[model samples]
Target: ITPASMTIVFLSITIGTIMTMSSSNWLMAWIGLELNMLAILPIISKPKTTRASEATTKYFLTQAIASAMMLLSSTINVWQTGNWNILELKNKFSTTIMALSLMMKMGAAPIHFWLPEVLQGTTLQTALLITTWQKIAPVTLMYMISNNIQPTILVSAGILSMIIGGLGGINQTQLRKMMAYSSINNLGWTITIMAFSPNMALMNICTYIIMTTPIFLMMTNMST
Candidate 1:
């Protein structure tokens, strides 16, 4: 992508994430997610290699599925509750599906298989974006609805993510893939804490970003 086009995509990504984070309704959040997904595609495939193409396709499919699930759950919620309010999720089935979909979007485990592969195929900078900036919207949404989600499900998923993330990274040689697992691990901790304290979860994410950004930048500078 050209500099101008890159600038535009980056802006779109930012706007999309902000839209999702700030939206009070599920429809707007879904639209923001779609925008975010679309904007990131070009960045993922910019290298134009076979691996990059594969990663782009994988990412698009995974995100599309998650977004579709989110939309379906939200629609179900609207059907049952007669409102589109984010804080008004009352249908049990819809709530579970929405929670799972948000987890999928953020690459929390069991559903986390796509992440390492996608990161490994992209440039380090793109991988950095995948692990960091791409997380905010979904995490924010999850936080918004934390009260509606079952604590048991949240705790189980969180613990499973932590286990998988830790165990999965041990044998990885690729730096991007390793970071992917690490992202999973850190997010797992965040999710676990979010079950009891959301503010702490938010602070954890901020801390993760601050600590992670420089490492990725340094690796990028060294072309490692």
Candidate 2:
């Protein structure tokens, strides 16, 4: 039951990501986020362990807050700019808010405290999905709007993610938590370089995926 529920959750997140990546309107993106959050809630809570339940509550609460912030930011953007088009994010402040929300949703630094705990509570397969597939949509959106996003903010997030990730993982006993932190570190590398060159950002993402895929596959095989 757990595995099946997790599969459904994965599918929902994938679909939500697709919706978010393709949508040009702010409301549509919000719907996609809602879908992603709702889908993953079941997976987090299904383990039926005390730690798992606690992690689920944490994940859900954090996501809800992020979602609310995103909506508020979008509303502010629309009110100030008189446009709902995400592509026309001319208001710098709103764009910053949106970027921050996205970073939070992706489990980036400062807002990343929930990730290790959540990953620790899940199975290896679920962790793999969280690290990889769940990232696709948010990263795609980040890349799309990179031109408009503030360089300072991006750099700060990237550096914080790298430092926190590395320091947090060194003493971890759980393999899942270690991998989660490793992923955060890799995302930091990607975001850090993204500000220097778009081409390098793409390369970083591709390379990270290539390097991580084999490890995840191996873990899955061993777990099975």
Instruction: Give TM-scores for every candidate, taking all chains together and pairing residue i with residue i.
Output: 0.98, 0.90
Q: Write the per-residue lDDT of candidate 2 for residues 34-107, one digit (tens) a residue.
A: 89888877776777799878877888888898888888888988998888887777778888888888777778
Evaluate all candidate structures by whole-model CA lDDT and list the values in order. Answer: 0.94, 0.82
Best by TM-score: 1
Clashes found in each candidate (C-alpha, N, C closer than 3 A): 0, 0
For all predictions, the C-alpha RMSD in Å is 0.8, 2.1
> For model 1, what is the C-alpha lDDT against the true structure?
0.94
- Residue 204, candidate 1: alpha-carbon lDDT: 99
